[model samples]
Target: MTNSISITKIRQLMTMISLILLTLSITSIAVRGFNWGLDFTGGVVADIQTKPDVTQVLLKSHLDSALSQDVQVTAAGNEGNWQLRFNDTDLDLREALNRALLPIDSNFQVTNSSVIGPQVGLEMVEQGGLAILACFVLTLLYLSYRFEWRLALGSIAALVYDILIVLGLFAVTHIEFNLTVLAALLAVMGYSLNDSIIISDRIREVFRAKPDGETDSLLDKSIVSTLSRTLVTSGTTLVTVSALWLLGGSALEGFAIALCVGILSGTWSSISIGTLLPRCVGLEPNHYKPEETESLQSMP
Candidate 1:
């Protein structure tokens, strides 16, 4: 057997961790709910350019006091630009904001402001859900045709696992779930699938080459052989995403964070759920047996 870590032996541990995370995520979502942004729950998004002296804290306090409600204020590109999000659609709120900012800088300008209606938010939610569902179904079909039903099922399960973990983390952390975050989730799914496919193909190749080899040893060796590639790919991606998270400004913050978490979870699922589930469901040498052998054996 290869010197690679025995992922199969720790299957139970992984399952337990997944269950615990799922339970915590569900509970957090049920209790605290998501810190939905203007894109989801429907509200106003404004981009403003304030005086260089204006600070995030001062802006937030002014907006809260003027609007009589909490608002999300984050630094946008450059220094004076700021992004504001809140659940208020009244036109008067705009006037109120302008008046409130007069003390800081009479010249401050509201570059843009837009409202998202509740109905529109609902439609966006539906569309996002459909997109994820479509990805899952299509992935299953492709895998089934390319490999087998067992492998397809396993790959889908891993995908779900990756998504759930990411969702759970967001819920627990109270991160704003917005359209950008949804895009991140989809991107994560694609990356996770790529890893799963690589591992699956390697396993299939090993089966075809060494039909008489022990399944456990073959699985271990296959995973070990591909470990370098997995590490390199995932490592490089992580470095880029991490940099974005740290310095990409608030607009891309959620997107970057989502990618970072998803990459980690996806990598784990590719190794654990991707390989083990198919094995548990009865993947065998015969699944890859040469067509010529089956034809000759049947003719006798």
Candidate 2:
């Protein structure tokens, strides 16, 4: 116990860190804005396999000349594989792209094409927002039912912190926000909540075992005890996600990046924000104490 680190001792510092991150994230979102993808912005995406001579710059120039509008061209996977994204989805536009590309590489072929309409894009935006809101509400209800209101609220606070940090990085880096990224956010919520629940449960158990112990001391011990498991879990996840981000190509880049950010943020918030927020909200030993003890105390 003497050797254990006192996490509670630095609660104020952790809170300050969280507030700074939150402020930076919100401010960046306000200033830079999300780089919305075709999934949310009504556009066309085409995957083409070009000849060895084809390059992103050359393909982009050809498509730009043909379409008469700006288009994004990116390397897809192995050499000569490219992806083209445009706001226009007209049939003539598609034909024109093929014609223009033929001059560069007559054998170049469109491997895949997708078009998202304005209405569909709007619907996706609304549905994605609703999905995130639903996750938050459901998480609150479950945590409250399983433990207590304070624990539930703390978990939610940590979740918000994790999300904001991830989104903030996205804003600052200008990473594309798409359906895959949104899915990663949901996964982060679940991952962070699991860590929060484990820590909260340990704290409750500690309080029950030593009812006379200082809440701060109990919290510190609980955090220290579970520190190993948290690190192991987070480490393995980071490794896997890091590998995915490094090799998964542009298709999964946003998803992998979001997951990477989410995992790091979640781990930090679960330890700092999740545990401390409960104390700030007046959580006490009596909240988890037995009925007999409570009744005995009330006998006065």
Candidate 3:
């Protein structure tokens, strides 16, 4: 068998790859945009109960044909429960939905129905954008206060990297970008921030303790010291998120997907970008060295 690559080489390779992927993610978002859901575009939302045998695909296909329009279908909390979204501009949504399900389940019931106007959708879009911007601004301020500028910037870069990659996945797949998915994005920022802070803290400690050590060696040592904690945390998180994705129903599928991607990306960024960016920007042990007081300097 061939020998495995060293951790040093691996870090170098991953850093290069991360930068390239980050560029592609930005490009994809710019060019393709997102598949905005009814939450942002304004449409009818209906929760219905159908025959137990009715699947999302079957229901969607029939609705598409009967209503003569596109319909978005997702499984809700329980079997036979589904949420449907579609434009209601020129349709009697309740009547159309009831008639469409007649053949599949005569007893089918429309449990709830609501219409989201274009103006409301626009307002939600604005509010969601502002919330994310606000989060970034707050995160930067906190990180800057806690760490040196290089480390602070590194953590922010990792957050951006993780977010862009997740957004790019949604854009490329044309997944519906809804409020639930937006909530997941905010969760991702928090997770990424926590991971970055842990790794950065360890690096700072190691740097101060081994002021004479080589940068690469000190970084490797610091990361290795925290490797087990990172793996366990990430592994447990992936397990929970995997269950959520598999069993949480379609209403939460986007949310679960976002968390899964965010966890993995956050873990990788914590180890790679968080450390690499600082080193690239000339981070040195002196930055973490204790400052001398005027009295001590004068006496010395």
TM per prediction: 0.91, 0.87, 0.89
What are the lDDT figures for the candidates, one per model?
0.84, 0.85, 0.87
lDDT of 2 by residue, 201-237 (tens): 8888998898777778888888889989998999999
Q: Best-fitting candidate, measured by lDDT?
A: 3
- Model 1 CA RMSD to the hidden true structure, in angstroms: 2.3
lDDT tens per residue, model 1, 66-130: 88888889887899999888897875756888867887888998889888899999999999999
By summed lDDT, the worst window of 10 consecutive residues in model 3 runs over: 1-10
Ranking by lDDT: 3, 2, 1
Give the higher-TM-score candidate: 1 or 2: 1
Better of 1 and 3 by lDDT: 3
Per-residue alpha-carbon lDDT of candidate 3 for residues 64-182, written as tens digits (9 for 90 to 100): 98888789898888999998898766688767977788888889988998889999999999999999999999999999999888999999999989999899888888788999999
